[model samples]
Target chain A: MKKFLAITLVLALVVLGVAAKVKPIKLGAVLPLGDITGRQAANAMKLAVKEINAAGGVLGRPLELIIVDDEMNPSKGAAAIDKLATIDKVDFFIGGMSSGVHLAQIPILKKYQKITVWIGAASHLCEKALAGADWYFHLHPWDYQQGAGYAIGWKQILEKYPQVKFDRVFLAYEEGAFGTASYKAYLAMLEQAKQGEGPYVGLVKEFKGESFKSAAFGGGDYRAVLRLAKEWNPDAFIWAGYDADALPMMAQAKEIGFAPPIFIGAPPGWPADFGKSPLSEGVVLYGMWAPSLNKVSPVAEHFYNAYVKEFGEEPATYFAPLGYTNVYFLVEGIKKAGTLEKEALIKALEQVEYESPLGETLKIAPSAVIKHQGFTTQKILQWQNGKQEVIWPFEVQTAEFIYPFPKWEGR
Target chain B: MKKLGMLIILAVVALGFLFPLYAGPYPLHVMTTVLTYMALGLSWDMMLRTGQLSFGTAGFFGLGSYAALLTTLYLGLNPLASIFVGGVFAAIVAFALGYAILRLREIYFAITTLALAGVFTVVARNLHDFTGGPEGKILPSAIFNGDPTKVYWLTFSVALGSILVSELFQRTRIRFAITAIRNDEITAKSSGIDIFKYLLFVFVITSAIQGVVGGAYAQQYGFVSPESAFSTNFLLLPIAMCLAGGIYSTLGPVIGSVILGVLSEYLKLRFPYGHLIIYGVIIVAIVLFMPHGILGMLKKIAQKTRTEVGGNENEK
Candidate 1:
């Protein structure tokens, strides 16, 4: 019995030694693992980490990815970040698909002063104002870029039908930082241009809580917005929200015969999976990137090919590209820094500039605001039949923008 | 014997409230949450004493949260006052429901209460015009003023108040009625006890306590969402804690909530993926080995020692 006890102690000590030796650079990826957005981002991120480690890796150290599930709740998101920083002791953090979850994580990130590279959130206002150290960065485009790109696509729609001039354009958006910023930017650009100059989409609606209607803002239900659209006879309608909020309202809009001449939405439900619904045709939506577009760079071409080969389908959306690019950016920064120390890495991030697959060389600023050099560019896409096609930035145009979607005779 | 037990419990309660002044914020937060469940568990026990088992604490908790939030939003009332109003709202709802459904005993009552929680969730979601729906609302930090320690102390004070009231009720003649009702309701009724009246009284009182504590939870966190407030995590953890510590007794719930609460938090960090499994194993171990709960086991051990001493005395 004594001999057996001695052997057990020796085994335990050996196990402890093994555990002590198994150290890798721990990097955290916070995502809504149990939610839909996380489904895409989480798998893509794990794949990115696997590929990175298979290669020589950064600074001669293998990368270890620690994933924390936020379960799509903001409080959970915040708590996950806190756990990652305090308990997991990670070197840096990345991954978020929802703006709400993303917003919830910012204060914690700022408090920890850990390098946080955003994957898919496009809340420009929040991203620009995040505090802590010079570590917060975003690979996604801001609302200004998305809204401006949509506007450029809208101009294409108007060019197709000269007689399609209308009096007003109304805006409906989710009441959050991302939607609010995007709506304001879109309105400013529309008002500045003489397009709908007399009665430019002056009406703005923001909804809060579970109410189908905005009681405080004189908006009630989707029916109210639909009726107002028909009465005012707007040339187009813009929705600045996510798929969760927009898809239902869009379905209702189609049912009401209020399919405006031009329909544009923010990234949430753009090119939404309309399935058999005919209303989805000719709907122009703005996003940070579209993997459908064939870029000129060999590196992007390789990534696009590898993604399809590995994932068994064409990258469904630009989210995969954002994850891929962000990972690549992190690798480049680590390589440039030459040390794993936070200060050294922050200096390297501030100094280094590199061209990404998105066709821009991102340069970091040392200020608290997360800024990258280069004009924000997004490829415009329109839903045709079952697939989304790149239609704008004529240089990369895959198909001509389908204007006045062939009226569904079935309706 | 009951008086001595009350005195000892009061002393412990006083210590529990004073604990926050020395504890760190993290410990304080865990303690505060434990106290919240303590209030919840005791109220649950109060109802159990009268032979009613409610699985719908989440419903009253959710209602209380929404009430506090709505009161704050619509009326801009102070946080403390809103909490009282929220608790009253829950009691009123419980009273109305108790009138109709308290007649059913055992599983029927338990199942109905559980289902009602689902109904409350649907109502909250449908009322998204007021409630935030699935998304919920963010509470302003101005209420708690950004101090976690202060919040912990506040929660501790509220928890002590809840425990005191529960102990007070447990010693009253109503307690005797509740005990008599639990053992044999038909006999108790024949002996001049109003079974329905007593059940309703306990139900309303316990539901009110749960509602107020839940309101305190919302105010403390500065955020309340339908899913979190009505979450199974909040509901089941308390029940499990009560069971693990020893059910149907005040000490049992207190001991169970603290041990399980702290253990769960620790395991969550150690093994995020399998923490719930770890929690389950610990709970099962305690239940299987100590059916009478920790308090009851201690009593048995103490009695065995007393008999052993008496045996030794006789031999001498």
Candidate 2:
């Protein structure tokens, strides 16, 4: 019996030794995690990691994905980055669900020299990178692109869908850094058009009839302001804000029965079945990488199919594709580098061209004005007949922009 | 007993100074956070002793962070100099504000401090050009030089300084005045404790410490947004640490900080999902079992052990 116990202990030690010998490569993700979007990102990453392991993990070892919740705050995000860099000693870091979180991780990334990928669209995040450093890469449309995309779509409506007739519009945007930057960019684009400073503006605004009024509101107490805006009854009510400000305003718009011809702007509630809500009918949102887009790549289709199969439903948030793409990008970079070394991975990341859900052959250009991210094919999606459809960027548009939105009562 | 306590504290400080020797950069980073929170706990205890339940840790913390960032951005001072500037800024603000707001007793004072926190958030958001508004500011990369170990030592010193301040406060006549007020304000006022003056003094000291802690936080993290700097974690964690360890004592906050800090890191690693819920449950258990705190429970255990030993001796 004593010999039996001794052999069992030795066997257990041997198993432990073998397990320790097979060190898994860790992929660390920093996200808000509490929010639905953040949770979806985590879930999607988990699915990708599972598939990668099943297919025989990287470097003959299983992959371990560690998620740290930044809670959308920069300081916490920085702390999370520190843990990933130092404690967990993760081989690669993928994050930047928010621009602030991404920005916070920059200094630490410099310290660790770990290859970092940012998926947030905060325009200035990567732009602030030191001129020569090439260790970091970014994906996702910058706020400038998002703003410009909406403007171009609006221009398309102005020229093509003359029946919509958007003369006098009302713009309501949250007064945070994001909303302010995007709104200012939009205004500058319009002002450039007003002066014919840019080539596309004069041809688009034929009558200078593009008159609009705008108001900046705080994050809280949107109902009263929305009611006041409702009283004005403009041609279109364009609201640009985050989920917090946008969600409340959307619910209150339903309460006040303030439906305009075009309800267009940034995402508030989300890709999360906003179409199913009676209040969200005909509302358009500016976003990056929608599944509803027409120019779908085979890689994107495979991702969507896998996502639906694993999640048992279509992704409620657009983050699933983003999360999946981030993993694949890192995996592809590693494969190209032919080693797990940070410098090699970073060099490969710079030259990486992968089939992302957003674009075919999605590539990153290091240290330009756009700074590490370039993909012009962002999608502006609208809810039409209880389904979200891509409506902008003429080549990949799945459906026409539904202007002259049906009234809340009628819907 | 007092000598033993001091010896333990000194030994801990000495070991803390040597923490980076063995711990990796990640552990050092987490230790820096633990020290920052421990300092916050000590500072919070200072105010609680003055018979005020101030909920303005986040306010002063955010204020200090902005003050340091603006001073460095505009004045081009060293980060260390900026930390002092932040502390001075917080002290001046607290001294002036306490004159008006310190008169309110108990719940009113608590509510006022809570409102002041909201005021800080709005002010930070509005000061776009200076504070970088909601996005906040990241210290220039030159500021930190990317040394987590050095930052950990700096935070350890700041945290140790806060404990020393708490110890010094307890030793002074100010402690007697504050203790009297905490026990019974009207009686203490009758005994000429000068309630407002004592409260204001404690408020200034605590605010200054909190400001320095915030500056240290911004320096270490290298970034601070209005939301991150003014995070309720600054308010909640320190308060929880103080209460869980044992309020109105120097070692309580220290013990509490270490326990909670380690537990929090462990939970963050082990249970990322609903960890907040798990954390809440642990706090509830601590409050229930160790009503006075961990120190109180320790004291009880010590006394019980002594009794059991004496009883055994007598039986023999």
C-alpha RMSD for every candidate? 9.0, 5.1
lDDT, residue A25, model 1 = 75
Best by DockQ: 2
Weakest 10 consecutive residues of candidate 2 chain B by summed lDDT: B134-143
Where model 1 places Cα greater than 4 Å from the true spot, the runs are A1-23, A97-111, A120-135, A138-234, A237-259, A263-280, A294-301, A308-319, A336-380, A392-396, B1-316
Model 1 Cα lDDT, one tens digit per residue, A29-61: 876544445655655666677788899667767
What DockQ does model 2 achieve? 0.38
- Fnat values, candidates in order: 0.00, 0.48
Q: Write the per-residue lDDT of candidate 2 for residues A200-280, one digit (tens) a residue.
A: 364333211121122333345666657766777777677766654545566778777877777875643463555676767
Winning model by lDDT: 2
lDDT of each: 0.67, 0.75
Which RMSD does model 2 reach against the true structure? Answer: 5.1
Docking class of 2: acceptable
